[model samples]
Target: MIHSVLESVMTANGIHSINRLHRLFFKLFAWGIMGFVCAQTAYAVPVDTKSYDPASGVVVKIAGKTLVMGWDTPEGSTELTLNLSGKGALVRSITVAPGNGKPVEVLRDIDPVTILTVGQRDLKKRGGWTIFFDRTSRKPSESGPLTLKLKSAIVRSVGRRCIVELDGLEGQSFSGKLRFTLYAG
Candidate 1:
């Protein structure tokens, strides 16, 4: 019966010692399991997600920041390479309109441009590093309306998906929704 009500509340507090009331009930059950594992790890582990595959990749939101690139993308000399393996400068952004309506500027920095490298300098502010998509997109257009800047630079192919909400830089705000694959060489 709860050990006779913990031996009548340890003999009215004088503590008659049943191993000091079982070490004060195992130190209040180890401080209630360390306060429930520090309140389940003190927040910041809620992720909220959804996915359907499509080669699985795309989540770039800058200004606050959040990038999880990987849509298995790769195409050059025409452009369409957003591999971010370079860690992408963290959104310095010469220009990026993930909304995909258009404005996908930053048509340079494909890693110091090799193949005998002939005259290449301007990397458009070097934002986030290596993010191709500019040869004027060769063709394929008709999903215009999320909004992009840099004279309406367009990049969409294979199966499009771009969602944007970027404002400011290095303060911490994010709204990203992006899927990948665009090749127009």
Candidate 2:
């Protein structure tokens, strides 16, 4: 029945040759298939959403700047206090560089009289996270590029600030940069 109807429509349009009719039928079938494919693709929905992982890192700030240590005079010693805030993060290690020079394991003066001590202050509470310089003490005898092991449960939320003190340098001039890394696990 559909074939008869198609034949009648072709006849009404003055189409008589079977070759022209076959060509027209195939063209219409191709166009219908192309339209269906385009429509399906245009309205297709994603099977699943793309997954992503959150960024992880510790943030260190010193008066809102990365470079915090500096000396103004040639005789007096300078002290630097840095604010560290991280979520379940701890200080893995702290290193010091002498202005484009190699990093030293210990921060010692040329005269062997000056000493460096690194300490930590809770800043808000007590009996919280503490900074340990060496294996058995809170304030390590030496300094410079030392890995101060942090108690795993340290820095619960707001965290604490590192207090560094330079002593015994009565008449010396120094300039350097300190680099510290924090890790969250």
Candidate 3:
């Protein structure tokens, strides 16, 4: 009877140990699967997007202000023009919005300048555009809220399209949108 009791006790302990090991293995597997799923979901990229053509209509907003912005190249022209002449449309009006959602006119007929220029690879030509705010009118009525209205002549370059990037206007970085349209003339 004593031997039988001892045998039974040993069998029960063996069964318990096996069960504990199985449970530990299951927990580890579950954790690994959960971690993999979380990683995949976090790093997944979004799909399905619309194409933006700068030629149609481009509106750039910076610090809660809208500005007209785009580029134009002469027809059958291989070179980029820096001088803000009849070559392209310049930024005209600048509107500033106050904290209370009220817009105040700050600037009109704003003069734009080209700060940087780069040459084309094949033609070895350089071209770009930049607009500068008046030094006297740099101060805003409030802390934030500014907008810009940009106008440019239609781009007429055939081989390469002009690229217009707006920056260093109000703050450290350039924030805005661009719309471009191609015309026969």
* Top-lDDT candidate index: 3
Q: Kindly state the number of residue pairs that clash in model 1.
A: 4
Models, CA RMSD each: 17.2, 22.0, 22.0
Best by TM-score: 1
Q: List model 3 lDDT by residue over 70-145, tens digit each.
A: 3222322111122222222344444444343544456555445423222222222232222232232433322332
lDDT score for candidate 3 against the true structure: 0.37
Please provide, for model 1 over 121-152, each residue's C-alpha lDDT reduced to its tens digit, 9 standing for 90 to 100. 33464462643543324434333223111111
Clashing pairs in 2: none
Worst 10 residues of 2 by lDDT: 44-53
Q: Pairing residues by index, what is the TM-score of model 1?
A: 0.27
Give the poorly placed runs of model 3, Cα more than 4 Å off.
1-13, 46-185
| lDDT (0 to 1) per candidate | 0.36, 0.35, 0.37
Q: Give the TM-score of candidate 2.
A: 0.20
What TM-score would every model get versus the actual structure?
0.27, 0.20, 0.22
Q: After superposition, how far is residue 118 of candidate 2 from its true place, in Å?
A: 39
